[model samples]
Target: MNFSYELIEKYKETKGYTQDKQVISDFEEFNSGNMSKIKKGTRHLTANQCIEMANAVGMDQKEALLKLAIEKSKSKEEGKIWSDIVKKISAACIAGILAAASLTGQVVTPHLRYRR
Candidate 1:
């Protein structure tokens, strides 16, 4: 993941206007500790740490996290919807079988439903 100093600066500018001292304190603490330890000088933003800092700055961490979550949810919902469709098709097939059996003058008892 790419770290944008411009973006961070923009977020800082936006977030700095707030009355939240805790955020500024946390940013200072992170800069003094973890951020300072990275030797790559500004090129060391990992995906996880970006997420952490985004949260610290009161930015849209949920929106970023929800990217993956939304995709997973969409996939799950799509699978479920198609599974229900398949189930409906299977039920239609069963109904067709029962109709065929009835038309053949056979005694379509409830026990015959077990054939499905």
Candidate 2:
């Protein structure tokens, strides 16, 4: 949910030309007056806003959205991979500990005993 101010600024500079002032103003007006208040600590960007901003910044909205989506998906995939690796390592460690305990005849219970 990282917000890239650099990307926003770059888009603004490219699209906020003199001739595009009216469009930019319209966008600002729409955002400030009509769009719902954004909640804190949330990463939510309206599709219309993205399109408008992209239009203002001389970039394709679909491309920007696609890039953002791809980045998010990649991060999620990486996290899942890391989580899987951690689970495997934890399981292996537990298995090793159990094996060591068995080798040392560390049986747990008053009712049962290790014959070997």
Candidate 3:
């Protein structure tokens, strides 16, 4: 899966894995063969492996899982549905971030915050 490839890329950069075999060895339950096949988009990481990857790479677990779902879909139609949902989730997350960053902490209102 492309997402798996991206994860491996991030892992390589962050953890200094120099080869596909090295990355595969670092994670449990993954075949060294598939690590190389992933670059060709002919292999997929298991769902649990996807979660592990997301955690390892500091990515959102839900997003990673959803993207994996898209890749795992049995049909293009099914993939479309998953793809749409992932896109909406991504957009919503971005909107939430933008809304929060817009003015949430920068403007001090009369209401007291309780961080202390």
In candidate 3, what are the lDDT values of residues 9-102, reduced to their tens digit? Answer: 8878778777778777777777767776888888878888888878888988898889888877889999999989988987999888877877
Q: Which candidate do you rate higher for lDDT, 1 or 3?
A: 3
State the lDDT of candidate 1 residue by residue for 21-92, as single tens digits: 433364544453443433234344445545765676665764434332332334678657655665676699
As for candidate 1, its clashing pairs are: none
Evaluation by lDDT, superior candidate among 1 and 2: 2
Worst 10 residues of 2 by lDDT: 32-41
Strongest candidate by lDDT: 3
C-alpha lDDT of candidate 2 relative to the true structure: 0.53
> Judged by lDDT against the true structure, how good is candidate 3?
0.81
Assess candidate 3 and give its TM-score to the true structure.
Answer: 0.73
Candidates in descending lDDT order:
3, 2, 1
Error of 3 at 14 (Å): 1.2
lDDT of model 1 at residue 110?
A: 60
TM-score of each: 0.29, 0.35, 0.73
